[model samples]
Target: MKKLIHTLLAGSLLTTCLATTSAVNAMTVSPQNWWAGMQNSSLQIMLHETEIAKQQWYLESYPGVELKSITKTDNANYAFINLEISPNAKPGKLLFKNRAGDQFEYPLLTRDKQSAERQGFDSGDTIYLINPDRFANGDSSNDTVQGMAEAASPSERGGRHGGDIQGIINALPYLDELGVTQLWLTPPLENNMASYSYHGYAITDFYNIDPRMGSNELYHELSAKAKQHGIGLVMDLVLNHFGSEHEWMKDKPTTDWINFNGDFADGKHATSHARQTIQDPHASEFDKRQFSDGWFVSTMPDLNQRQPLLATYLIQNAIWWIEYADLSGIRVDTYSYSDKAFLADWTKAIMVEYPNFNIVGEEWTSNPAIASYWQAGKINNDGYTSSLPSVMDFSLQESLIQALNEDESWNTGWVKVYESLANDFLYPNPDNLLVFADNHDMSRVYTELKQDLAKTKMAMTMLLTTRGIAQMYYGTEVLLDNTGSNDHGDIRIDFPGGFAGQKTNAFTGQGLNSDQVDMQQTITTLLNFRKNSPAIAKGKLTHFSPKQGVYSYARISEQQTVLVFLNKNTTAKTWSLDYMREVLGNHKSATALFNKQKVKLTKPLTLPAMSALVLVIE
Candidate 1:
């Protein structure tokens, strides 16, 4: 075999190989590197080049390692090499060569100590979600690149504002001080689209970070730096689709790689967005296909996860990221849109590899039944099983908004929230659900509450103390609002101090108004208090029905008990503790979290109107 000359090309290593005596072409391999001793010994490495399949390949003899097979696709440019590394395999370079004397090196690196035993964020953590482009710009030089499709336009709502991984790393101290235990940024992978790519849903390169955002090394650096601040990183991943501008669009990998044979057919192939069809007993095949196989938009080509090769590719891609980036968790975007079986396999593979790791799927449904069906322990009537550890609580998000915005009524207001939580019986593990007031996709909670600071505090206080893993949007602490417009650009507005020319800087508390400071203080207090609360972490929740515009609940644990009262009334009211006798057992007195005053639990508690009161009992 002849040695191949290697050259660095566009952040990825490309090898110039001889496929034939007269032909020399470049090939790129994915998953930059892999680690030994992974739970699964099997590895499927993909090679992309001109007529890559034409060459016969073999792996150099290595102890405890064997090349199982090489699968070629319908397209001449792609080849999938399957290899198995034994449990005792050590870190070393594996040299692979073809019959035409072309060779390349693949590295099997060492795993971090106790990597598989890494703990995922749970009820004990407060996840802060950030839109990197809107967060801060630590590096302004990479704002525009020679090959990137879009330029940085700070004024344009949809244009890239140049928020990179360094920006997130720079704000780690602020996040840690605010008691944020985990950070979930929108997909940091390369979008590389012509427009509106700042949101990061349209993924172009799964293996690489966007150069305009940062490099792969920088992303790894982010995980390391964030860990030092006691923060875990949760990567947002898009598996159902890819940006249309991806190289796969230019050169077909296989006939079945993309759904609908890579044709949108003028919006006729668009998804119905009816997520219910997945669990509907009588749902038709056509409806299921229309919802699952249809494209999200013309710019994003839906992937054909039903294809076995593609299924393996996505599953391995997710695992590669977890091992490569030292990720704490994964938040899958458009989770249900992918093939159900593939999702099961994808999630199961990761869970099997890292039993302690967590993955939350975005179901985006207001129905508890639909959302709970995707959770791990659900005994689905359809005989379907899911390995997903967590599901987003869209039902609570919608109900909480309504509960705060609507007037007091028997079936509305606080009752909406009460009924929503009552549906917790549907989930196998209610505490594992991801609960949040607002996220990157919707209107800010402050704006939803009509910029009412009191209501905003109540909403956040209730959310933080609720019985689930909590996630907060980037600027909720300082009241970032998109009052008049519901546009995505407006919803994901720039962080004040994160960029230049901003009068206010949230990081330093510069030029902040009274309400902003108040909200900030309130969030900091709740988050900090929640950090050490045993009741909030693993306690049993007991709540009372809404009465007289007040909703009350208690988190009971062996070490601590917490009482929360949310009053929606416009005036203070005396709340009876008679109904909470079972939960308040022998707790005569407790200290209020907000006011730091001792209150007798036996007496009728005075609940301030439109406020949340949290009491801790030792």
Candidate 2:
């Protein structure tokens, strides 16, 4: 392995010989490595080094790969090499020699056997959201890396904690037993910021994993191990912006690499929050430009996706992860904040390669019409065609919270949820939406329901059985709350007993109180039952309007019908069977899975106060 980097002064090709032999030092090649036998033979290899453009290089042909073209960017340090890898190509190295006698090699490994056939997470999967920095601590040694800016400070809300990839890998069995089929971890990629980098949003390196979290090899290990436990890993990434410490910041590939507040020289950008401008009909060009081009914060520099090379780089980065880590899905942060055209193209490119893969965009809008515009087959009036398979159901999430908290009235309590679902027509494929009661960014579901266990259970039941992909934050099952404040650090609390010598361990159930244990068991039972329920997985849902303080819905499939009822009354309410006769049809009796009791459809069933009932009918 050559570690020494040799470079010549500012000069054209053959100005000087820096090294007599090939060297693999001082160069960043992304994707750092690639696989042979890909569906698309074309590969774009991006390279950045000290005055690398001035160097001369030629491809030493190998069995599977062929050199196509080397396009130098505006920046002298950057170069884009295009290659054609034929299907007949096998795993090997494609050697190259520069004019100055320095040699470099690109490894072409065999693709995973299931690369193209890999299935992404979908509506049938239950996603367990983990904020790794706050989730658990498996390896204490990686708590602080030497070169990293932020070190481990588990006690602080926004400070880095020791929770790494191993932490997540250690809790696989716990998650599996909880019945979560998919794992959605917030970005584990490197942030390398000065502070407050625990959230992993301000990424400094796209090709490498956060050393504090783990290594690139370990990320692969986690994904592989997760598959064994029947869990699919969904990688969360930010394409819109990157941390100021990113390598490209100091030496951008082009003049327009990033939007510097429409002024690149001095760098003092103005507008930061402009997410709504993309969909606003009255939005001006200036506002739209600012929204897509403005930085998220002074620490995060907004990338210019309009730059063709930059756009391609972002697209390839996502594809590289799916191929390298065997990821089942992608959760793009601030989806609509990026260039709209670039988003459409970016989603289309990935879907084309992995036709079965799922990518859920985070369009955090409460309006159904705006949220629907990003989903596939939306047929927007703007004539935009988005290939995204799913979107985070922000509209439904908000409605569910409001529905459970307000008093019963027109568009108030249960009607809020009913009305939210009624807007399903606006969405192209409502069933594919990603639904959840709360996430790392918001108040915990327990806190949102004001610590009311019954209301919490009702919200959980509604989300779990609804017609969309269901997701739950890590500490939700144990009643994690951020009651007094909305600080994210409070919302994304560290798991009890995640560290050594801790007293309360949610995993082993060693020190949890009765209420915590019960909530955990409740979630486990509901998720386990939902895992095999065809009626809840892919069934057609029909919900009746909330009436007399009672809300009911039925998930109907060819073989079974799953019925759910929620009573908002403070007092136990007896519901008549006559009202639901149309949905009941010929089923004489239904088994209540919650208590394992059978209820006769011919007779009225009394529901406990503020209760949720789940019944399976054949």
lDDT of 1: 0.91
**Which segments of candidate 1 are over 4 A away from where they belong?**
1-3, 7-24
Per-residue lDDT of model 1, residues 530-567, tens digit only: 88999999999999989888989999999999999999
lDDT of 1 at 433: 96
Q: Could you list the CA RMSD of all candidates, in the order they appear?
A: 1.7, 4.0
What are the lDDT scores of the predictions, listed in order? 0.91, 0.85
Task: Report clash pairs, candidate 1.
Answer: 2-101
Off by over 4 Å in 2: 1-25, 261-272
- TM-score versus the correct structure, for each prediction: 0.98, 0.95
Q: What range of 10 consecutive residues in model 2 has the weakest lDDT sum? A: 8-17
Candidate 2 lDDT tens digits, 265-323: 34445454666676778989888776777776778888889898888889888998999
RMSD of 2: 4.0
